[model samples]
Target: MNNIKSVFSINDLENLSGIKAHTIRMWEKRYTIFSPNRNTNNVRFYTTNDLKKILTIAFLNNFGYKISKIAKLSETEIISLAQKIYSDKTDSNFAISKFKLSMFNFDAKLFHETYDKLLETKDFEIIFYEVFIPLLDEIGFLWQTETLTPIHEHFISSLIRQKLFAEIEQAQKNANFSSNEVYVLFLPMGEIHEIGIILVNYLLLKKNKQVVYLGENVPMENLTTVVHHFNKVNFVSYFTVQPEEENLNTYLDTFHQNILVNSPHKLLVLGKQVHNFTSFIPSIQCFTSIKQMLNTI
Candidate 1:
């Protein structure tokens, strides 16, 4: 079956195109840029074709094209202009914009093509840091602001995760180090976000360290067992949404009493929830960002 998106709401367009829903309504009302189908309840719905057209319109508008002029352009003309913008190799922002289009269309081909083209001039790390990271930040903002849906976020995140895992597997195969420290990565219970931890795992492998990746939603009770098994263990975790502000200290205290008190190990944490604590458990280190964590690792 084709993965083409056949139905969309105004919010979907707003999320995918970075155009406000109010502005989209204005374009539809004033310039007839979109001819949406309304349901019995009078809710607006759009087809995949509308999605494509709006993506082009948004891209052109970003380039200073007037809405009045854009509304008059033929479909072929708009598509040609979009293709030109997509092919502009000098604009890094265009790369991100194209990826947003791909996410909206569920077009994996577009994502792969854009990434491969970028790899011609830069390595994966550079593309990730410069393009993908900023793209992710935008996606997060869109999700938070209710402009993007979970489906849209998941589509892009899953593709980027595949690349991260591929790199990690390759690194693991070639990794050889004499360091006795074994890094164990996991997400706390109730916390399902693992991309940050996965990236950290990749970084650890790249630095020639051994990583025992337990993955997401690991039980806190298991940490003691893991530490007991390894001679020199370094527990690494990402707290994206787990361990609520009130529970953060309690969780750390649990780890302090159960794992660190009896073992000779260190805890390194990275996430948005790390700063809510007034104090950290002994032997625990909190990082504000990926770069800070990478520097210490």
Candidate 2:
């Protein structure tokens, strides 16, 4: 009862392995690296084993091993080579390749092991700032280019979110919580992306500050109600895709006029949409990046 699906298309292979369909076809014809099965209607399809093999081959190719050398290796030999590659401390490409393979196969154990190994030599903040953020950005690009599907993005993001949440929880457990200025982190209505806001909450909690996280798609009106009760509350939000560009100015204007103008508390904003009104943005300190905001705090 493994319940694993078998058949996959060329596009699926490309998405899972990061090997272009055209390139895969070329490898098949020119190098005989892979031999895919054809359906009755002459459509190319690959199996689970084929997907694993291609990922292993892609990992080897990324590590400077020529395609010819990769093709000559037996399946057992390829697995052995991947195991050896995983042990190399200097090979970030190998680690990233293994991470991709884990994501493709939904192998959480492998993902955790690889991340833990990386953490032994690199700090979590460095990993987050240098590796994970860039990887997520690349994932976004892949999504835009139709190289990955929503399912692929969601699966990987969910795993990352789990890790972030665990770290946040541990930080909260050790927090001193002596601050009077409690931050209330939230996303405005229609904004379901909460990863950035979650990270901010984590940062605040790590600093031992009280954080009230009202996660994703929160109504602005509801936030106003909370602000009325919590006098020491500082409202923080991330605008990734919510409040469409056309309406961003209106939203900010209303928010500034109603919530920020008379209130003693401050509003901290970040993400791409914040740039839309940079010229018209009030003299109040609103950060454009997490680093800027963290420095101010």
CA RMSD of all predictions: 3.4, 3.6
User: What is candidate 1's lDDT per residue for 52-81, written digit by digit as tens?
Assistant: 788778878888888898888899998787
For residue 149, model 1's alpha carbon misses the true position, in angstroms, by 4.8
Give the TM-score comparing model 1 with the true structure, all chains together.
0.84
| C-alpha lDDT score of every prediction, in listed order | 0.83, 0.77
- lDDT string, candidate 2, 157-253, tens digits: 8877988898988988898987678898889888977778888988888778899988988877777777767767778889888788888778877
Candidate whose TM-score is highest = 1
